[model samples]
Target: MSLEVLQVSKQYGTQLAVDQVSFSARPGQVLGFLGPNGAGKSTTMKVAAGYILPDAGDVLIDGISILTHPIEASRQIGYLPEHNPLYMEMYVVEFLLFVAGLYQLHGAEARQRVAGVIHDCGLEKEQHKRIGALSKGYRQRVGLAKALVHDPKVIILDEPTTGLDPNQLVEIRALIRKVSQYKTVILSTHIMQEVEAVCDEVVIIHEGKLVAQDSLKALKQNTTEVVFVLETQEEMQSKWFDDLLGLAKCHLISPTTIRLEAKEVFLLRTELMQVLNSHGLTLISLRQEERSLEHVFYELTAPRYNV
Candidate 1:
């Protein structure tokens, strides 16, 4: 499954919720929709799922517009909105049955699928529990089970991990990763770590517009890729590392370390060692830092042109 949002925008009265955002995701990949609170991430996901129409532009799944073919589009999509709704009076199995009916599933087919997803989502322990009686974690699992009941090719999840305990979060995240093996997943969240955990790509929105889209590795290099830790016999205050700050794109991260944003990393690494040797500095420790997603998030979300 492939999802494409083309120049989409949404407005309510005078407020624009999404501003001409465009992106695409493919099967076997999780495109992490990320932004701060009220950054239009949820609105974008809702629009893509056809729950909300865009005032301008269109959402396409496999080249079919949701507006022209809502049912067909929805048939290919399974959406778990930020606030999942459940009939409190319905038991876990009953709610799924009701949802299955909407998708025209019945008889043994529905029962088999419901059983499969219930097991996959870890809802077996609470299968007989009513929605109102279950804990928040179980409610979330129920929501996910409902989404999976139809076995759609595309899954759009909005803040799926919100309001869960740490253990629940880990379990749900693992389930999501397991499911993504066969489907296209568009996961919207304000949490940065979620993207780092399972996402293959990232689409960052800000103030109702698409700002940055890239793999996490490329984004980290926007600031610096090389994390150099040098501990010499000299005191921390020694100017040895300070002098190396004159190197292009080098940042002094600490008294003993600096991060280098070199254009040619391999050449720079060799040259850097030579420079250290020339300075009569004994390099006690030197290694490229593992690129981190937290650093990438900060750079991509930070105000452009310093605001």
Candidate 2:
């Protein structure tokens, strides 16, 4: 493991932002730090990056404790926070060089790392622009580049894809995949597709408490629920699905769509298509949903309705 968060906790006055959360991140794979907003994802990451002192426990970057060896551990860890804080007045290349200088990287090494991140982060085109003038997506790239410029063994990115367009998303995902081959990466995000797209393993927190930690496959396999969504060109009637037998529940999302859930798999799909056909409705789309991290996340983090 390149990064280890050992029973870390943080409190903001009376409010406990993180409650003894613990997880490890291995190199050669992306570890997803998954949770709903305000679930202490950012705070935990800040503690690990040595940006804040934890109220309890410790974080290790390549085995150096952030609590005991703050300076030494920080040197081995790079963090791009949820809010990409940048000096607005500085040019992209200037800002990166400034960051390198703060890390005591001088002369040839500074130039080399700055150059490396600019190319790796796809920021070559935007490198000359002033930080204030760049678009949100490009700024995000700059922040990521800054995190990579140091070439730390551990990288923590909190919601790194916040401002990216679809094309940019693909490029950044590929970049992350490439970098994680040699370094440990902790990716924090609420977007299920982002986690599914890039993460190899997962660590989830709920209400500041450690909830689930496992391989992506294991979390997905823990559930047996099957979901199938049906979309039609014409508005679907609720009564049409009222008498469906095999389904555990039928939820009409809108006039043109319905979500069907079942405890068992297989025949529910066949029955659904047959019904739509019998009703003379043209099928626009029908897709059986996989047990996605999104579903698993909901189960783990959903609020208590009973309360």
Q: Give the alpha carbon lDDT tens digit for every residue of 156-245 in model 1.
A: 999999999889888888989998999999998767787888888989888898988887666655444454445554324323333453
What TM-score would every model get versus the actual structure? 0.78, 0.81
* Candidate 2 worst ten-residue window by lDDT: 298-307
Shift of residue 143 alpha carbon in model 1, Å: 0.3
Error of 1 at 53 (Å): 0.7
Q: Global lDDT for candidate 1? A: 0.80
lDDT of 2 by residue, 1-307 (tens): 4888998989998999999999999889999998888899999999988999999999887788888889888988889999999999999999999999999998999999999999998889889999999888788889988998888888899998986899888878888888899999999987888888899999999999999999998898833467878888887776677666566666566677776777667536466667888888888887888777887787678653210
RMSD to native for every prediction? 6.3, 5.3
Where in model 2 is the C-alpha error above 4 Å?
A: 225-289
Native RMSD of candidate 2 (Å): 5.3
Candidate 1 TM-score versus the reference:
0.78
Who wins the lDDT comparison? 2
Predicted candidate 1, C-alpha RMSD: 6.3
Deviation (Å) of 206 in candidate 1: 0.8
